[model samples]
Target: MIALERPDDPEAFFEHAAALLAEGIAPEHVSWSGGESADLFAAATRAPRAKWRGEKLFAAALLHRAENRFSLVYRALWRAARAKGWLGNPADPDLCALRKLEGEVRRDSHKMRALVRFREIRDAEGERFIAWYEPSHFTLRANADFFAHRFANMRWSIVTPDLSAHYDGEVRFAPGGSRRDVPAEDARDEDWRTYYAAIFNPARLNLAAMQSHLPKKFWRNLPEARVIPTLARAAQNRAEAMIAAPPTAPRFSRASAPQTEAAATDLADLRAQLACCEKCPLHREATQVVCGAGPLNAQLMIVAEQPGDHEDLAGSPLIGPAGKIFDEALRRTGCDREKIYVTNAVKHFKFTLKGKRRIHAKPGAGEIDACSSWLHREIEIVRPKVIVAMGATALRGLTGQILAVRESRGKMFDLAEDRRLLTTTHPAYLLRLQDEQEKRLAWRAFLSDLAQAHAMAQA
Candidate 1:
């Protein structure tokens, strides 16, 4: 075995690994030398290195706290050089192990960044800040630039057992020192403790979550950590006190009645309210509230999912490409588009932008729920004999239960007060089917469902 002494740093390891690869040294034949023993083989020849420093995973794996990391990383690199695209195969055991090590190094770096507590210290030259931190991994050097960016104008020094970093206008590194070298107490510490206590909100206190973010291991250096236990003990009483506190008067008055009472009282009032509705985020970008357009007392009510891009701009439902398909289906089924009430489950068009064109995005459950009030108001006002619900969103709004279109189609279910609802495929679904045969079949099914709804309305 060509035993070699491994250095305790990434850049050094990079150079060492590159030399081994150049000399054509097999990974298994190499053993790490430490203490008294050393390599007696000819010096490793220089070769073109694998771009390990430029690769984030390789760089982070080198910083892992494990003792065997040096050999493991060397082995991985050796295999990667021989086997094409081995590093990219995440399913490989070696890559998985390497990823775990990288995660540990990153987590350690994050902890060091979060828990480092600085204290004000004045030397003969000027005011500066010093922090003493104990990180499990060799991450002080890796995280030094973070502090530089966060506190660019200030002079600061972070001293760990393995390394130390200092920054004024520029960053510099020095040899590590003991925690005893750092001053434990500072004048600003008391003020920090006061601030920590003042900002602690009892109402939002989550002990498990707090412990997860602020581990007990870091409490030794944090000034506010001393009071954490006391605050936790008193949290229940404090929260109760907050809950029992006298109700404050409204800072700004809204129309006193609830949305259900006010908005649902009349269809005209609901439409006016919906135009300015901020109930969900969908309204923020939508052109206008595309309310239902049809005769007031139409026998059949047709509810589509929501407005499409064209319908959004034109301020009408079922006027886009999907609308054209629906019109074709209506013509085939002998159903008059003007005689029936046509609206959407949601009033606004929800979409994501792809280049200049807007791609339709399915509305989430929260958005659907928020818009249900308007739908309910529409139903109350129109009071149609039969409702044809196109797509899952429409079915959900009318029935308040998720029903599959394929399973529920061609059948009518009672929807209270002698009214009925028929679930069917949306015209947009027909438009998405690329196969001409499948499109033909789906359109026939849709027309059949619409014809059934029309027949039910007449009955």
Candidate 2:
């Protein structure tokens, strides 16, 4: 094997790799070392250079914390030289490895930037800031410019175990040192630590989540980490105390007081009242009021758009071709249609007479607003744990917001009385799609949204 030695960084690795590639040396024949072994290719030395794009890729991939990262990068470079757009092909093993490394390095660099805390130190040059951090990757040199740009007005120094960066006006690097090199205590550290401790809510304590972000490896450098154990030990007691205290009055308790009695009254009487409703002009042309059907104590409530031609004649909701798609989706999600409450945003069909047939028409904002009263009353009666709002009109009816189906599909929003509203495309919308592939994809997505609602309802 052709043994080679270079600096322990991406730039150095790329430079050496580029030189070796120019020399027509294959990756399989090469045995690389990052300052650990003597160079056997001393006689094969040449000027090291790479393309701009290649250099950029190396810069990002170098930040990875993998042990054999250099070898993987070299393999990727070897393939890249032979084929154009090699990196774009994710099926390539080398390219995939490089991309994975890039992601890890990017996260590592972000954490280093967020977690670093500066301490004030006095020297011959007056006041200066110093911070010590330990990163998972060799990202100190790559991230040094961030500190220089952020603290351009102040003189600062950041020391890591593998590297050190100092910035007065310009950034410069020096050899890495030990934790003893940094001051253990600072005057302002206690004040910030006390402030953080005071604001920490014990009731919201999630130890696993907290540890995932601010890991145990980084705890030694953080001032707030000193009290983590004490706070964690007392979290249960503090949370119990908070729960034992009397509940505070809601913000709109008085404003919503009068409606509570009305909400508790009979729902059948409410449906009877809706039969003669003329709040909107849609009630005039429709055959009859299509009230919601299903179990009274259903955990899942599916709200669809306005009634179609078949549904309008049948005096029911979700009974046409679109209903077939919905039933299939419900079956795929293991949800029983008989056990779930089904309703429409508008009780009337709102369709245009096309020759002898009635063609479906979209409900107007005024119609949806007028119909919300009945929808809200159904919610108060059924009291579903999860409400699935299919299509834009259904969402507008429930939430008073006309967001696009693509924007809010499969996302849950909090409604009044602890009910969650999940937005998704209507089964009717699926039937209207022209492309077979797109229709199939949309059908799958619709089923996925139904599954989410099913899971939420069960929970």
Candidate 3:
């Protein structure tokens, strides 16, 4: 049997595996030599090497924090390299095991972040902070960067059984440390416990949920845990007291905008107020409210559904991928983009997170309705001769009714104040077309609608 050497280091492990594969070594021919899983100063990575880093599943599997991670990863990688349905089958046992390992590793990292409590200390140089924790896995080095970024100005050290990390402007990982190496408590710990008790709502207390999040194993080290038993014993009386207590004014209320509030004097004034508008929950998640751009006196107004990811960050409308297509089409039709007022029905971007990327999710009817007031005020100010609504969401935001853009495209309808409204497929729809002929036909139809709108504005 060919026993593995230097199995702790990722690069060395991959190199060994690569050489064995090149020698046509079979899986059963190899035997596992499971030693301590990290090499300290020499090389301490428990992840896949450079060549296999691109395979997300394999790389994540290598971070399992289990003693058998190396052997399990090699078996999984071997099956994958041999095309043994490891990559294709979602229910593959190896893949399923890797997913569970990755999830537990991630959970351990999150708990370490939440539970680490730093206390002030004095050294030969100056004041610094030190904290000690007994983490489930080797996460002290992995999470050192998070502490460095969060408390960049202050020096700190986090000690665990597996390793210890010190940050004096830069991060350095050292050998493991014991709880005696750090201070047990600081003067400010009492203040934190008081604040924790103040925020603990007895009415919302769920013991199972609380225990799940703050496990009994961690309670000994946590200062706030001292008050938990006392609080639980008195929870019933506290809840009753809360119910009998007289009602007080709210901490905040958006709907309570005073009736005596001053009205906006002009477009600029209205826009400045929109920037601070928290009338709906959408504003809380978005970067900022994006108001319309272009000449207020312009005869043509182009309205899209809402600001996309690009527009949200840039704090402007008609600047993303869809905007590029719309701008090119308008220029082709002999219409200057700057001459036309550009905006969205909803001023905030609505999206869901996909890794680091934000994927656009369609806004709901209520969200559109919440922002309808802003759209109506914009229309009142611009008083455009022709208004173009790009999609169903845009049409609904404008008129407060679900109108079919497919049925209404290219047909003009009279709006209030003798204004003309037209509907068309959103520029984003063109990018989703799979068939060449269908894309060409749709592009032609889109150009025709824009040309017709420009013609109506000119007339």
State the TM-score for model 2: 0.51
Give one digit per residue, the lDDT tens place, for model 2 in 389-453.
99889888886665777867877777755778888999988888999999999988998899999
- In terms of lDDT, model 3 sits at 0.78
Per-residue CA lDDT of candidate 3, range 1-459, in tens? Answer: 323343224555566566655556566655544344333333332322234333434544454557666666777767777886657888988678877877777788899899888889999989989988987765565677898999999989888876788999999977878989988889978987998899988888889999887789888778888898888888889999988986331121223222213456668987998988877788988999999998988999999999999999999997899989998898889999889999898889899999999999899998888887777778778879998999988888776678777778888877754688888999999988999999999999999999999999999
- Provide the global lDDT of candidate 2 against the true structure: 0.80
**Would you estimate the TM-scores of all the predictions?**
0.54, 0.51, 0.54
Cα lDDT for residue 443, candidate 2? 88
lDDT (0-100) at residue 40 of candidate 3? 34
- lDDT tens readout by residue for model 1, 339-427: 99999998899999999999999988888878877887787788899998999998777766666777677677766756787889999
Kindly indicate the candidate among 1 and 3 with the higher lDDT.
Answer: 1
- Considering summed lDDT, which 10 consecutive residues are worst modelled in model 3? 249-258
Winner of 2 and 3 under lDDT: 2
Candidate 3 clashes between residue pairs 3 or more apart in a chain or in different chains = none
